[model samples]
Target: MPNCQTESHPPATTTSPPASKAPQTTEALQAEQAPVARDWRAPSQQEIAERKKQLSPDQFKVTQQQGTEAPFRNPLWNNHAPGIYVDIVSGEPLFSSKEKFESGTGWPSFYRPLDPQRIVEKHDDSYGMDRVEVRSKSGDSHLGHLFDDGPAPTGLRYCINSASLRFIPAERLAAEGYASFAYLFPEVKQVLPQSEPTSGR
Candidate 1:
């Protein structure tokens, strides 16, 4: 969860006060749960241009120019591997690969975001297509679109451009400083068929 926009909720790694306690003062409790303040400033147009000079032409086009990789041509298109996907522009982790699955419509799709608050959704009416545009909540960098036709729990498919993401395997989550979340994935769990979310329900 390094360098992410922990917007409304506290980081999932924070150590909560013991629940055994009768409970503390309301003010003190609220203070403890508050998310850390973040500096939301972004690079100016000129600064963005200046920074663009540093990226390769392709990276610049994809990251700064808002160009997308051809459908199914990118490596993440059919990726069902377990890991996380990071923002190509700022290298900020955005979606977990564990949640990735095929949506048959091409492009990489995920059931949910690694961090719900790490992204911001905006009504995108571009190209005469009414789509939900997804952007980095912290960096505000354009990632891609999200759809409502995904698998359950949160039936949302974060259909993102592969050029907009960089995948990192689960084994490297710790090396990437997201080790604290290892528990999120257990060695074994009750898994349901794609058509149903309950194993014996």
Candidate 2:
């Protein structure tokens, strides 16, 4: 979210004309902020285990064991294609190509999540350094760390593990049941490669 200064607005004067209608009620406020239906949800544990079987050892380690991959060597680090990144375990949409940026960290970096509610952050004290660990809210897969040093509009960098995410290219969104996100990359070509063009996810 963009940073903004809190501006003070003067309170309405009692001398002002009477209001034409009542202010928004509690129910109205709740309705306005209600959660919307999501296109995907967490997969079953059985499904997750099956998916794990299909993943590479490194992928499993990074995502399941909270391990970090070597910098500049991971596949998704240099991916520049237009697509949405989903949790490998649950297939929930995590980040969009639009939010991805080159952070020189040799990992997939995003300025923000595709859906903020899909991610959860925890205090990570495993390493010698202090950091906020990121994870999938539903799948509980370890993604990576978050840092405040990032470009605007949101000063946040979500450095993620490639193995923890699956890319659904704009061209293949519909085929992969992510058609709702196709609009985000309207200019992206419909033709897609059989596999992720840059690296394995």
Candidate 3:
């Protein structure tokens, strides 16, 4: 739910009635119009079946069966790119590069999510470990676990599975229909287009 906001302009004269609501920021407006506004509900039985066929054996196992991939060897563990990570199943934006950090855990770790609402945390007591399990709200895919040991700002580590996510580089956000999130990288100055949503890999 963390978002950017522009500074407000001077207030209107008290003589005239103030507007009922404040003006929406550019980010807010862009979010409302973003292609991500499409329905991102839980996958149905048929959808799940289709996904099983579309996804790789490792991806399906980790995301659908709650299986974990080997650490350090996963695709994104050492990734240092400027981009966003989204739910592999639903394509819902989950984490940004801005929050990513090396946790020495050999997994892709983040201090927080791009939008907290897109993530669901549940008490996990599996394998004799008391932890919090992170899942994608829309896709209902088992992402990974959360731990308290982390860096500043947010003292929480989202230890996620690479199989459960798809990385979209900053420059390709607009083309990938995630233009609203382009603001996360101010250094990449590109006119983000309003593109149609894509079915994630």
In terms of lDDT, which candidate is strongest? 3
**Which runs in model 1 stand beyond 4 Å of their true positions?**
1-56, 186-201
lDDT of 1 by residue, 64-84 (tens): 555665564567877766766
Expressed as tens digits, the lDDT of each residue in 60-114 for candidate 3 is 9889988888776689977889999988887878888877877666678876777
Question: What lDDT, from 0 to 1, does candidate 2 have?
Answer: 0.70
The C-alpha TM-scores of every prediction are 0.63, 0.74, 0.72
Tell me the TM-score of model 3.
0.72
Best by TM-score: 2
RMSD of each: 16.6, 13.3, 14.2
lDDT of 1: 0.57
How would the candidate models be sorted by lDDT, starting from the highest? 3, 2, 1
lDDT of 2 at 121: 83
